[model samples]
Target: MALVCFGIDKFPDHCNFVNGGDGSVSTQTVEKTSTNRKLAPRYRVLLHNDDYNPMEYVVQVLMSTVPGLTQPQAVSIMMEAHTNGLALVITCALEHAEFYCETLKNHGLTSTIEPDE
Candidate 1:
C-alpha cells in the first residue's frame, strides 16, 4: 500500500508493493515500459557527373552548399563523381537532403536525393 524507493531512485528499478491486510510484501513486479522511439528517416544527397560544370565549379558548389565541408572533402566528393559518375555528398534528414540537392542543381550541378536504404 506504500511506495518506498528507500530515498534512492536507482537502487532497485521496481518498487515494493505491500498488502495492508496481511502486512506482506506482494510479489507482483512493476515494470516500466521503455520508449523505443524510431529515428526520422534519412535521405542521401548524390552528385552526378556532368560535362557542363567544371570540376572546380562542382567542388566550390559542394563546399558552399553543404556546411562543414572542407576543401579536401569537397574535392574528394567531386573526384568520386567525376570518376564513378556519381557520388554521395551527404546523408541527412529529408528536408536537409532536399535542400542540398536543390542548391546543387541551382548552381548548375547535377544532384539528386534518394532514401537511404
Candidate 2:
C-alpha cells in the first residue's frame, strides 16, 4: 500500500492514505498561505530643493516622471520640496526608484532615493 501527498512540504502538517481495493485515489491538498507583512526595506524617491533649478522645471519633471500627478499636484509637490527641502516623488522598488532618481538628475534636477524610515 503506497500513499501520495501533493501540494505540501516533505513533512506535511497532515497526511492521507488510500486503500488499494477501492477504485478511487485519495488526494491531499496542502496550501501555503502568507499575509502581507513588512518584510523588506521600502524605498522612496525624493526631490530636493535647489536654489538653481526653476520651480516650473521641477513641476515639469514631476508631471513627466511621477505618474498620476496633475500640473497643480506637481506644482504643489515641487513647492513642498522647495520649502521643506525634500518631498517624496514616488514610492516603489529600489531599482525603479533609483532609476527615477537618476533620470531626474540627468534632467538636471536634484533627486535621491533612500530607504523609507
Candidate 3:
C-alpha cells in the first residue's frame, strides 16, 4: 500500500490529502473499518497442584476467588489439578484473570495466568 500524507490531523488514520488540478488542497475521507468486531484478548488462569495446600482448601479457594463457580465445578478443577498437576481455573479477560490469580495467590495457592490461545 502506498500513502502520501500531508499534515498530522486529529483523524490521521482516516484522512488522506490530495492535490486538486486547480492548485487547491483537498482532503479525502477514507473510512477504516473492520468486518468483524475485535474481541478482547482472553487469558487463562492456571492452578498448579502442590502437596502443601489441602484439596478441600483448594476447592474452596477456587469457588471463592471466582464468582458463579459451583461446588461441583470447583471440585472438578481441584481434582484436575491434583491428578494432572495443573488445571485451567478460568478463561477470561486480563483484569479478571489477574484479580482471580492474585486472589488465589492470596489464599496460599499456586496460580498463574497466560494468554489463552
Clashing pairs in 3: none
Alpha-carbon local distance difference test for all models = 0.88, 0.81, 0.90
Compute each candidate's TM-score over C-alphas.
Answer: 0.71, 0.66, 0.70
For residue 91, give model 1's deviation from the true position in Å: 0.3
lDDT of 3 by residue, 1-117 (tens): 234574566657667867776677777888767889789999999999999998888988898899999999999999999999999999999999999999999999999999999
- Lowest-sum lDDT 10-residue window in model 3: 1-10
How well is each residue in 1-117 modelled by candidate 1, as lDDT tens digits? 575453356556565555666666664466777899999999999999998888888889999999999999999999999999999999999999999999999999989999999
Off by over 4 Å in 1: 1-33
lDDT score for residue 64 of model 3: 87
- Point out the higher-scoring one by TM-score: 1 or 3: 1
The alpha-carbon deviation from the true structure for residue 13 of candidate 2, after best TM-score superposition, in angstroms, is: 14
Query: Top lDDT: which candidate number?
Result: 3
